[model samples]
Target chain A: MRAVPRCVPCVLEIAVNTVERAVPEDRQKEAILAATERVSELYRMEPTPQPPRLGTEAQRTVMKYSEDPDPYREEKRRANERAAAVARELESDLENIEDPEELLKRAAAAAIVGNTIDFAVAGHEFDLDELREEISSAEFAVFDLKPEDLRGARVLYLCDNAGEIALDKLLIEVLVEELECDVVVAVRGGPIVNDATREDAEQVGITEICDVIDTGAEMLGLLATEVSEEFAEELSSADVVISKGQGNFESIPEEPFPDVPVYFLLRAKCEPVAEELGVEVGSNVALRWEPEDENVRRWREIVR
Target chain B: MRAVPRCVPCVLEIAVNTVERAVPEDRQKEAILAATERVSELYRMEPTPQPPRLGTEAQRTVMKYSEDPDPYREEKRRANERAAAVARELESDLENIEDPEELLKRAAAAAIVGNTIDFAVAGHEFDLDELREEISSAEFAVFDLKPEDLRGARVLYLCDNAGEIALDKLLIEVLVEELECDVVVAVRGGPIVNDATREDAEQVGITEICDVIDTGAEMLGLLATEVSEEFAEELSSADVVISKGQGNFESIPEEPFPDVPVYFLLRAKCEPVAEELGVEVGSNVALRWEPEDENVRRWREIVR
Candidate 1:
């Protein structure tokens, strides 16, 4: 979806967060000022871009100012380690559930819980200590496409953050083994915030079960114009797309996926996203949006 | 103080609020988009103006885009009426306090409670029903300047919001009748946000006790270069300045007031303002700052 006015401040704040990590203390003030200036320039240009595009540009500007390629390198590592421990703890619990449908719902809920590990979104706070309790009791605001919908389907999973991807592996396992679905997962081409890469997928053991491909874009979300030929091919061929987190939730709708049924799993962390998905700000959402879904009609009207 | 990264989102949000009120329903999206674009342009300018300055420009841009001179006219009127009722109810309670100092502190606290009536600041929510209870038990974070400091002094009170000014009258009454001080009140020269104007002062019975002058600028805060000659003369001669609300609290220190002992009486509404005051966000402060006070030295280092 195209950006509403609320996105400008959040986009800039995310830039500031990145700058604090990338630049040293003494030069941080100068670097942040320049980064914000460039952000303002980008906003004022003709035909204002989507928020994800703006967010990517702001991150790029900060990196350029500080001459740092990956500001979130250390943070990503720590997040992955934390996510692994939580996933391992959750593995035994999943093994106990008898019904395949209940196990699939529980796994999806756990993956949605993992979306809370993100650090780039402004004013979003997460505590790993609460993850277990949250996963057990999570309620999806929109749960249209179910376990039966993905049964024996060709599925493509879009990963969001580093630590969050580990929990996503649980849902992928459910799809490949329990539901008899052919699953492939895609990470970003390079680092942008804490978004998963090939390294993250390998670290989280996502590569061991299914194929992993990079989107060939360093943006917050996978833009149709920026993704590699392989990713585009994979995206078009998939019968079902399990788009993870807020970024992919936003960018995926911009593409022409008339026949592909996409299930959006995320914690609605911001106002605009929550409003678009018809949920409260902090609600966990597992929405199904496609050409036939009601939200697609509303979204088309909004962007137009 | 200069604008921080956190201020950009709030400033834009405030602008959006203004645009929603100022523009027609069908045309709101176009107006809001243009207003935000202009706000970005303002942020990109040289020297990077303070958040208050940026806020003023954003409001003006929305008004200009919609061709509406005062979108807040009805809201300001309602605020003044509500404030008057609250003030009338508070008069008897304030009259019962026996000690002069205790009465002064209670009255100041009541006036600070009135600062919550503001609507222009982003994410600021105020409930008028709780005004009485909040004023009764309000505690000051910094209460350095006492009644003795203002006794028989030529006090200049800088007013903030419309409904807020009615409560401000409680403190002004304390200054004029109880403390035997020569009092002068200053409102904004023109309507900006819901800030008190000459009409607001007259509506709230402020004209009955003392002289009321305007700052001669339509900006969110008073600038030294923007005030009338009469205001400049009165500002130079005042023994103590009771600066009200966040806007004045921000702009008063930007001046070269080496000798003027300014008592800032307002709730710390935003983080940057709260950080500059060495207080927690949402704390009620009645701080005395001059060249001699500790905060002035710290503020000089910040603004430099």
Candidate 2:
């Protein structure tokens, strides 16, 4: 074999491939568009190599594993176990609380502290005091929140990635302890992207602290597929719904439950969503509302 | 909306979209695997801060334009015109020659040089003398001359980006002038990946030198669908086939023509192919011959 010249087409192959595997299955088209934008941004921001080579084999291997079914399931199982354990721990905390509002406050505090530790280790940084203040001030004035609304509400905390499971655990604890909510921490049924799987949740003790379920590997995001019969019953009867990550946002249509108060937490990593929110890309968001009402005011305030 | 801090998942969504686009309709699963391999490689090589993000809106816009029906047809039309022009130029060169052996030698040299320059820039550091010496020394070689066989030849061309289309132009010239072979110069169908497009080929006068075709809008690797009748006829009658780039290798199957000789010119950017070749990933290669018993000795020597 004679040596061929290294060229631009090869480099581009690597770059495109790298970006492609990073996306989840349901959002493949959106991901491709985002990758294109990022590449263009990189070119404009700096003097990149003219023709980026395709990703190296090692890189491709990692991407393959990231999307493998076994790893994803393992991650989910671990998270579920962890959530179950946390729920037990919170059971004792709940017994100690007398006031419903105070319990919610305590649960929210635990969630913040727990999630902060997890995020920090995962290489994320945030202002703890500010976050706490924000949570403390979360009033029904912005949206609608009634005691009956959250009582025994079925909450699903969809996880994202291995390292982030600990944070999800914290959030589950709050729903169970403070809100007195029936919580089900759902891990992806199989691996599609980097989202948590059943095993990952178990490993982090998330399953130990809450009821755990699988979303059957559907990439519909917030518009999660019908849960197992038992889980579905819980989901349909629940009053409050919480979905984590933008995949859920894309999958869950904006009008599924007009009356149910759903809280969506995600970072705006792509343009379409960011542009819709009128925020810079890569900004984090914690949007809450009932699909039935025109919550444009609430959305505006949150985006601002 | 409060900042959600789950941008990683959002980025994953974009990656998925990119992979879906890169994959052809029929080979979605293989394309997905190829994409996963490429992205995984990137994750392993680079740090997390350069965490993979999705394509931007601008990139998607470019992709849309590339896939537009009219532009695709126009690019093909222009490419045909360019190939005819190159044929005319080769005929002029042949008019001055009279010996069959000399004509064959010139044709082979032209094929090698033309293919090389098709995806590379002019004034590239290609050592023409070295390439010529390698081609002339080969014995018992097979030529993959069928256009149909071009569909799945795992070609890998090392590239330098944009301004180097001239190199590809020169290589196409050689394919016509020396080898007296019918050729297809494949490019990125749309603008998502940084590579020569049908338009790029037309812009650099490449269409005039050879048959111009799109490798679809694929970014991970090259994939060969059913050959067009015109190109298939050329392949059925030809004696040698040449392919360029790592994308070509990823997209196409390796043994499209079990009996004919196929030449792959690529830079090893990813692991699977590099590992198979026992070469350092990212190294360039110009591998020749059929993977059949008749060419065993030649194959072993070249691959070795």
Candidate 3:
């Protein structure tokens, strides 16, 4: 989504957090100020500042000043460890579910609850201890697709943050085993904020579940022009795309895949995203962007 | 208080709100963009961006772009009306108290609770209906002076927002009639945000209660150097200065009124102010800034 005036502070906060994490104690202030300046420069220069783009640029500024390619390396490690433990505890619960659709919803809810692990979004507070309760009580503000919609389909799962990916593993397992879908998980080509990388997915055992690919860009959202041809080809050819979080959901254009059924599974963590989805902030959202009628018709024909 | 990274969004939100209120619908985007640019400029230029200072400058940028002197004129008028109604409803409760100390605390709490009317502070939400309940429950987080301390002394009451000034009227009455303190209520000389002006004080009947003066400048917080000489003199000569709201508390230097006891009567609405006062955010604060020991000694001598 395009940046609103409110995004200015949120983006600055992301910059400040990234800078503080990247730079030494003595140089943090200088780096933070410089990153803030970069945010200003982008807002001035761009006709419409895209929040994710601004955040990515600000993160770039912090990296440049600190001379650290991966500022969130340690943070990602910690998040992964925490999420892995939670996922381990949740595995038995998933195993107990009999019906495929019920198991799919349960796992999807867990995945959306896990999106709260995102540190890039401003003012988002996640309590890992409350995960089970949140998942159990989770209701989709928008549920456009059923588990049967993706049955035996080629599903491309887009990953968001490090800790969130551990729970995404649960969803991936459900899609592969319960729904009988072929899944290819895509992580960020490089680190930008706390977005999951290939290493993060591997650390969380996602590589063992299915094929893993990179977006071939270290940006906030997926820009069509910025990704690798292979990834672009995969995006277009996949029968359904399970977008994991706000970044991927935002980056994907309205009509990027006209014939593809993309399921956005995330918690509407901020006002803009919430507004865009027609849901309350903090609501668990599972939406399918209305694609061209021909695509829906084609998908139904295949299902029949 | 020096602005932290968190203040960036807050200051930007203020600018956006101000510009939206001031400028035409067609020109709002242009004005907002320009105001954001100004906020960025100040952050880049100033060694430490004071949020109130940044806010004032951002408002100035909005005024310049919109070509309107007072963007909050209508908002202030509405706030005054709302606050006045609540004050009228609260007058009997304030008047019913027999013990002078209890009455003073009640009036002070009402005044502090009324401070929730401020619109400039980002994320501050106040309900006019809840005023009475809040006043009843309000407890000072850092009350250094007793009601007896201001007895028969010169008290310069610095007013904050428009609606809040009406409640300050109640506190002023208690100070005058109960404590027998000589009171002078000071407001901003020019329009800035929703901060009280001479007109607002008069509209709220603060003029009828006691002597009303102006700070002789348009700015956020009271920068001693920027205010008129008359205000500076009043500030220095007063036996006890009763400062109101976050802006005034932020602007007043740690040791500015070293020879006089300055009672900062405000709601610690923001994190910076809460940290400065060592209280939780949203706490009612009636702190006597610890002045030099000589001032306290002399005040006790006078009391004896």
Judging by DockQ against the true structure, name the best candidate. 3
- Model 1: CA > 4 A from native: A24-48, A73-106, A113-139, A198-211, A256-259, A269-271, A278-284, A291-304, B24-48, B77-99, B116-141, B199-210, B256-259, B291-304
Q: Which one wins by TM-score: 2 or 3? A: 3
With a 3 Å backbone cut-off (N, CA, C), the pairs that clash in candidate 1 are none
Give the docking tier of candidate 2.
incorrect
For model 3 the local lDDT of residue A46 reads 43
Share of true Cα-Cα contacts across chains kept by each model = 0.38, 0.00, 0.62
The superposed Cα distance between candidate 1 and the true structure at residue B6, in angstroms, equals 4.1
Tell me the deviation in Å of residue B68 in model 1.
Answer: 2.9
List the candidate 3 regions with Cα displacement exceeding 4 Å. Answer: A20-26, A46-49, A67-103, A117-137, A228-233, A254-261, A278-283, A290-304, B45-49, B67-103, B116-141, B199-203, B228-233, B254-261, B278-284, B290-304
Give chain A TM for each model in order: 0.88, 0.52, 0.87
Ordered list by TM-score, greatest first: 3, 1, 2
Clashes of 3: 1
- Summarize candidate 3's per-residue lDDT along B229-265 as a digit string, tens digits: 7776787689988989888777665223436767888
Candidate 2 to native Cα RMSD, angstroms? 17.8
TM-scores for all predictions = 0.81, 0.40, 0.81
lDDT of 3 by residue, A226-259 (tens): 6776786677689888988887676564223436
DockQ of each model vs. true complex: 0.27, 0.02, 0.42
Model 1 agreement with the true structure over B1-304: per-residue lDDT tens digits = 7766556667767777776677776565566556656666666665666777778877777777665777777788778887788899999999999898899988999899888755434444556457777888899898875878899999989998888898999999999999989999999988887878999999999999999999887778766667777787787688989989888777667644435688889899988899999999999999887744554454344333
Which candidate, 1 or 3, would have the higher DockQ against the true structure? Answer: 3
